[model samples]
Target: MERELPKQVFIDGCEQISMEFEPIGFRFAKSGPHASRRAGDWAFKISFQSNYLNVGGEYVELVVHASVYSKAIKEWDERSAWPASASDWVAGGQLGNLRTPHHWRTWNIVNPHTRQAEIANIVANIQTTVLPLFERFDVPRKLAEQVACSQVPGFMFPENAVRFVLWQLGPEAAENCLSYWVARLPSPDAFRSERDVPTLPDRLALGSDTNNLARVARAMKIGLSL
Candidate 1:
């Protein structure tokens, strides 16, 4: 029979990792004191990643109660993989009253035979993989680029994230994302008015240059017509 792993295991593993690592702090958050099916929404958030994500290569900031996790040993069953995603791990978790953005991540580790081993695996992943990746790339802009190119379009860019988004999706799309409405217009100059395109702050705007996005555009054969 399958049994749900206690939430304490997650907390302990995260706590242990936080203690050993510098500049990372693990926090366990739940809505209320008691656990409920509805109130079961909780997460293990690492503060270091949240603060530094995107600056370097910080891709993720937290791990939450997975909608589903495997019940297996050390060996991962390749067949039991979750749907592939740019951000395949969970997101949309909250820290305190302030809502954190989509930065949650879950690893490919399968549930080990004993609860003790489960904790060890999680802790090791947090220390070795998650932390290193977070400090490096912050988060991959490709995930956001895919969303930008998809049918369901509505991801507002934070100021600092604009440059990275532009690098991935190209100038027109980046401007469209920053704009009130996303338009596949010819160029930044094509807009009739400021209202026609979104106004980007000086720091975020690409400023009449296609060079930054040139490589990405060339590879995808996008933005060549413009």
Candidate 2:
């Protein structure tokens, strides 16, 4: 059988958070039922994208979509600005979802008084975890290499992370940079002659040991076209 809808604790959690994580700007687009603020194509502070609130505020699911580069809203930090939705700005980028996502959640705590503490913990975890990802790779090549090498025995990225980093290296080098990410493979078995390699896949298929490199080829083709 399926799980129940949002739990009562989650509902209370949403009520507590609505005050802090309010939807701030224009409504450019709707990502599921998220509350988004937008400017042209740029959107941020989108909320409720992954969680739900049931009738009477009786149940709530711990859904969140906090962006890593939110600090940009206050001041300019060029590295954090990515996946620019609108055109370039005089002060640099005003909007981005640059890195892949990494969701943070709070577990159920039936006690009413402790809900605030749970929310605080979830926020703290996200703040501490996010920026370091950007620090690891300044260029897309480094990112592509990291994604390829991430298959190490103990390696694990945040659950919300994009399997492949979605960076915006710009037209001058975007195609070249995104191209490098496609060459990585699951195993040396992929080092076959072009005629010997089977048809390349059209999309990324996680947990598939084989055909990964082939999928990369297709990712490059599609990414370049975009």
Candidate number achieving the greatest lDDT relative to the actual structure: 2
The whole-model C-alpha lDDT of candidate 2 against the native structure comes to 0.36
Question: What are the C-alpha RMSDs, in order, of all predicted structures?
Answer: 17.5, 10.6
Question: lDDT at 118 for candidate 1?
Answer: 45
* Backbone collisions counted per model: 11, 6
Report the CA-based lDDT of candidate 1 relative to the real structure: 0.33
What tens-digit string does per-residue lDDT give for candidate 1 at 1-226?
Answer: 5543334333344554445543443333333211111112222234312222212121223242211111221112123221111222222122221212344454321243454554465566545544443332233455446444432211222222233344445566654434422243345344333222223221213433332233223332334443
lDDT digits (tens) for residues 1-226 of candidate 2: 3333455455445545443434432232232333334343233343443334343323333545433223322232234333223222211110122223422343443344665776776445433442233334344356544544343111232111222333332333433433343344334344233214446433444634234333433433323232
Candidate models: Cα lDDT each: 0.33, 0.36
What is candidate 2's TM-score against the reference?
0.43
Deviation (Å) of 71 in candidate 2: 22
Please provide TM-scores, in order, for all candidate models, with all chains considered together.
Answer: 0.28, 0.43
Residue 194 error for model 1, in Å? 26
